[model samples]
Target chain A: MLKKRIIPCLDIKNGRTVKGVNFIDIRDAGDPIELAKKYMQEGADELVFLDITATIEKRKTLAELVEKIAKEINIPFTVGGGINSIEDVSLIIKAGADKVSINSSAVKRPELISEIASQFGSQCVVVAIDTKFENNDWFVYVNGGKVPTLLKTIDWAIKAETLGAGEILLTSMNNDGTKNGFALDITRKICQAVNIPVIASGGAGKKEHFKDVFTQTIASGALAASIFHFGEIPIPELKNYLKTQNIPVR
Target chain B: MIAIIKYNAGNTKSVENAIRRIGFNSIVTDDISTIVAAKKVIFPGVGEASSAMSYLKKYQLDEVIRSLKQPVLGICLGQQLMCKHSEEGNTDCLGIFNTKVRLFPPKEIVPQMGWNNLQGMKGDLFKGICDEDNVYFVHSYYAELSEETSAACDYILPFSAAMQKNNFYATQFHPEKSASVGEKILKNFLEL
Candidate 1:
């Protein structure tokens, strides 16, 4: 049976791991390669490294950091942040990343999704959607959640699947860094709307939040940053907790 | 020395890294001589079927691979292309295995990504690996079960998780990216 994945997302800035509340006011976490190795030892199913400073700084995701992580860790990992072109995806994948996530670039050019999927296969292309519920509807935000777009969250997810995204990393801006819980409603809606796998991100404060997202929504994975980075929740203990709750975790 | 067959596929680097982690040296190359002369050949791939097959054919790697006598392992797309046919590009494959690859029904998630357990293990490749041990997978098309199936995994349906026949072995999952369980399997392959 396919088990629910517990993913630790490392938000990378200037070669260092950092976590921010609400995608702002970022704080230093630790070294990325060390944290990645620790997560692998702790039984993380997968890892996601978002180059949070790539887009804003007009620099590509640190390929050196990606290669280091790839060399040190054995599990599957995705590299995201400033990936905007086929060449960008090529660099990261060549550096040993299993997948690459795109947000602003994909939104700016929807065809970019199909281009990367066609060039590197859809399975390696992860479409990350940062969303916020406002005025009773969820809107897609891009540029690391600094800019809002006209695309509705659900609509964008469905369209991304059509454009050949193999997975959706749905992060609720409203719940991000809140440590409350996941945005179950939007996560469920997007999961229902897309045939590809959806990873519920943001607002993961406790192990129960992982349970809530997996049981309440059809999310294939639950991703968190601060909780895992700060040792607030160790992955092995969390997996054990999930297993007892009848959630098939690995 | 080990040779990792490379031809227009993704994730070869990760495979090489994994080999290094397991304390073995490997070269990522498409050269026929290098692959033929290696003690073991790791045929790792992550890409579309038809294009990958064409690249293999372009360099006559299809024939070289079929002629290999040493232990040869195929991963993900490598496994699918080793089959007789694939519904992905409606393309004919290497025919190393007599199974057909089909797209999963849309009744569930298409890719079936993340960690999934393997069952019915019966080959040297799974020597120390336990039944129901989880391994990482990321693929939309799967090869059907056949006489060569050494292990199985269920997603939308029961499919070939690992298949073996003589010197040729294949897996629908990415063992290099499957962490410790995968490391054990790779170590087993290297030992064999």
Candidate 2:
């Protein structure tokens, strides 16, 4: 059986891992390479590096950072933010990321998903959807969840899969920083709607929240940022907890 | 020199980086002699079966790959192409392993992506690895089990996780992306 993945997402700004990563036993949590190596040692199933600073110059730095991380760690590395074209995807993948994720660009141009998939296989492209529950329905958001669109979350997910997207990284805006738990309702809805793997993101506060996301929904992976960054939930300990709960986790 | 066979596939750069990280240098090439003369050849690919095979045949690299005498390791599509045939595109492939690749049942997830544990470990490829150890996999098609099967995994149904026949070794999973355990496996293959 395939094990459910536990991913620690890092927000990178100006080529550095932004936000406080409060893990002990390490001096500089802000360094992306150092934190990535540590996380791999701690048994993180995968790592997602979201470059918040998506400028032309910063993308180069992000690629360099990805190269450094790739040289040090062997885990699957996913990079997102500012990927707009086939060239952008090629640049990052050439820099050593296993997958390139597109959110804002994908929303603006749905064909971009198929373009990357056709050029670099579906497994190389990951479409990220930032969704918010609005007016009794889950709606898609663009530009880092600041803009809302009329597109329904379930509808967009199905469309992305048909566009040849291999995986969907679904994030709930309402639960993003709340850390209460995953948006189980929407997560399960998207998972059931698509055959491709859905990675549930946002609203992960405690270890139990991780277990809840896995047990309640069919999410192939759960992604968190602050909990892992602040040392509140070490990946090894979290994996141990999931194992005890009879959850199949790597 | 360690040479990685290049074709119309993705993930070759990542594979090269993986090799470099383990304190070895490698070249990515489709040239027949470079691949044939290398101390070891890592055949890795991530693309449509028919197109990739077409690319291989265009350059006549398929014959060079088959004629190679050094230890060869194939990853994902590399392993599938080593089989006799693949349901992907109803394509025929190099019959080095004497196995066939087929698509997962429609009811099951098309691509059994993410980490999965391995059982029935055998041969030098799994030297320091153990049964039930986790490795990363991302594929919709799988190779049927055969005498060359060194390890097995159950996803939708039992299939070959790793296969070995003489000097030819292949893994359906991406050891390059599987972290420490995967690194160890690659190191084992390099040392072999």
What CAPRI grade goes to candidate 1? high
For model 2, how does the per-residue alpha-carbon lDDT over B1-192 read when each residue is reduced to its tens digit?
Answer: 999998888678778878887888899987887888899999998889999999999999889888888999999999999999999999989999899999998855568889999999999888888876899999999999999999999898999999988889999999898887888889899988
Name every residue pair that clashes in candidate 1.
Answer: none
TM-score of each: 0.96, 0.98
lDDT of 1 by residue, A3-95 (tens): 999888888888887763232112323678877777788899999998877443434448888888888999999999888888888888888
Across A47-73, the per-residue lDDT of candidate 2 in tens digits comes to 999999957977778878887887787
> Can you list each candidate's DockQ?
0.89, 0.79
DockQ of candidate model 2: 0.79
Each candidate's fnat: 0.94, 0.82
What is the alpha-carbon lDDT of model 1 when measured against the actual structure? 0.89
